[model samples]
Target: MGSGSFSSVLKKPETTSFIILVLVMVGFTLANDRFLSPLNISNLLAFMPELGIIALGMTLLLTAGEFDLSVGAVFALTPVSTLLMVQNGGLSLELALVIAFAATFLVGALNGFLVTKVGISSFLVTLSMLLIVRGTTLVLTQGFPLNSWDGDNWLRTALAGSFYIGTVRIYASLIWFAALGLLALYVLNVAKVGNWITAIGSNRSAAVARGVPADKVKIWLFIATSMLAGLAGVISSLRIASASPVAGSQYELEVIAMVVVGGTALTGGRGTIIGTIIGVLMLRIIRNGIVLVGVPGLAFNIFVGVIILAMLVLHARFNKSSERK
Candidate 1:
């Protein structure tokens, strides 16, 4: 490791986050010898992708000076909707999925419309959406888990199949996570959309005055976030071989925390996809470490809170320093 890299890597936020991730890995591995075990590592990989995918979407939304609290609701609603359409409405699995995603897209569009066209705050708009989507899901399922269809299909296999790497099983979701992460990275760093997002978040009035389509971009970002959440929901349901209206509870908070910890400014206009990926891994590793160390499950949230607070403090400090320079 020559430590020779681009100037961007020398920036404090990304550098510090990468350091913290390495330290967390080493410390957790030392604390629990099995933290590095293949089985546990494999399990973590299997489950982490769903959240990682959602966090990538959150990264984009936050960078655009907006957020989607309804993503968790979308994650829960989409898969359950698919299952219901297939099982109760007698639709093919593919058609059921299409309908479910269309519904999710409408939720996103509604959120965007309320925020942009109706002049509502994004937070309040998404919060209302959260309630609406979750309520609809509960009304449909009545708090019962939807049974996954047992028939073999290419969709299920493509979304959630596993492969062997000698003795370890590599999940399809992980591949999706990586692919989506890379795509997000390109969009955020290389595409014209990235510039539009950064400009809108940095200064909405100025961006609008300068001819950037602020409202349109924000609405599109909302749609993208919701669609990504839907995909995550599908992957999760397929992996577990079932769908539940209660899935993805508290996931909005988790994804936000991951994005913040990964060096994305909560205030918007700044983000790093690599840092977001590291943040996702860091949170998952901590949860896994807590379990391996025999800590009471009740204390898990407490640990997460402390870590999030500490990361925010560090990020804020580094941000100030960067401004000074």
Candidate 2:
């Protein structure tokens, strides 16, 4: 494709998301004047980073034609691992954090290895890993919340504290999210490895025939996804000052929804960091708006289901139109 065509195709996905974001902002603002207030807006933005980080990684994996259903479990375990290290394993906070992240990365690598090397379906492999990790956390913690590290001031400040911009709180994790988003964007758009990733996701068999190391690419993507989830978990744990085995129980769904809504194809080989960010923000705002409008918390799940269904329909129609053209 020529550069002009390529740029146009790239811009199309973001345009849809940008429009959705604008509509969401307008709808929420009309519903509640407080929605546009600096405090509420800042709070909304604050929740974006952790999910944004996970979604960024998940976007890459999904673009490569794989799914990581184990992310939420991995997320839950990271903080559990950190708590274990600090309390039961007698490690310092810093060392515990390192081990926590490393362990999550290793888990991700294991998922990748199983899917690529053992020739298992990515869905099945990560699904099994999800149960395994969750079960292990339960057995280790005996179904109780891990609460021994509440006094780590330095760790708390570094991982969970916010910087203020004239009274608006910008979280440390938000900074990490921005940095990682830029890095992921660069790797996807400007690097040779990004091409390989797109090739592998677009057509694994063709990628292999072209001498691309498909397995290696997949393994690394899995690890990267896991590391992002782990980091998010660690930050969340610090912010909450405790680790609960069930903390991230449904987070995988949220992240997947964010990616899909952001226009990342479930079939892979198509997505963008900017779209994922917009998708994440849109979902967050919808959830927040539900609360602001006094919708029952339980009813939000129904709303989410409806939103996902609508997006899927739109995606199918969009793809069909593109193919016809």
Candidate 3:
């Protein structure tokens, strides 16, 4: 009976992901003592929230049977717009932020409109957006970094400011990630809309037959996702005091990997906020660990690619086995 219980526990995808995360942490710590050092840990925590904020939204979209390929471009584009307005357009910072976020919301609304109303596949719609937004960002900046953040504002500091706890430094972005993650957790597990999202992902026809407002829910979700991505970008720009045209390039795949490896299904219908958080830590630790172990920084993607492939295969098998049972 104990063995059977253990077997059942092992069958859970989130449990499997947690085990892998622990193994990686152990392996890295063994490889380099600094892996456990407070300084390295501080640096790792500092890098967590921007990517994390984006991933939280991606988790929701994926769980609702959708994807947003333009999030990466939006991550770059939103901040670029805000900075350009502040630096060159003579707009007040507060007004610039309001306009930038409003534009972000519109981008998501457009993607949702094309997918839900115009009958386009989410992939094709978002892929086209990815190119368009990325191109616009590059053309606006002419491929240069915008370093015109001349003065600090309370808003910037509130979003990404640094503070110390004993010897370790922390950022306000971490607080944002935590608060938003908890809200996402509630959305996935507690709310009526959560059930609606899962129902739509699991079986759209059935959900609609049962009176779920599939299109509206998905459209609102897209808007929320875009807002999250844009917010992360703003936080990152504030932290670094610069907006780079090329920032967040290729981040879509990485964020997806974090969701998938964290035990979210590629097919939608199921996912876990806690698991996704663990997945975020796993990848971040892996990146930090690889550098400590003397691996070339440029080859980090090699590790991520391999992990994504492995997880996809494992999950497919796991899902198939559950079906057979």
Residue 159 in candidate 3, Cα distance off native in Å? 0.3
Scored by CA lDDT, what does every candidate get?
A: 0.90, 0.85, 0.89
Candidate 3, 90: how far from true, in Å? Answer: 2.3
Question: On a 0 to 1 TM-score scale, where does candidate 3 land against the true structure?
Answer: 0.95
Q: Which segments of candidate 3 are over 4 A away from where they belong?
A: 1-9, 297-299
Tell me the lDDT of candidate 2.
Answer: 0.85
Clashing pairs in 2: 63-269
Scored by Cα lDDT, where does model 1 land? Answer: 0.90
Q: Number of clashes in every candidate structure?
A: 0, 1, 0
Task: Give a tens-digit lDDT track for model 2, residues 41-115.
Answer: 789867888888899999999988998999998888998988888889888888887877888888999999999
Top candidate when judged by TM-score against the true structure: 1
Tens digits of per-residue lDDT for model 1, 1-325: 4465555466657688889889988988888899988899899999899999999989998998899999999999999999888888999989999999999889988898889999999999999999999999999999999876675779988989999787678899999999999999999999998998998888889999999999999888899999999999999998888899989998999999999999998888998899899899989988888888888999988988898889888988878876854
Q: Once superposed on the true structure, which residue ranges of model 2 sit more than 4 Å away at CA? A: 1-11, 153-155
TM-score of each: 0.96, 0.93, 0.95
- Candidate 2, position 146, lDDT: 89
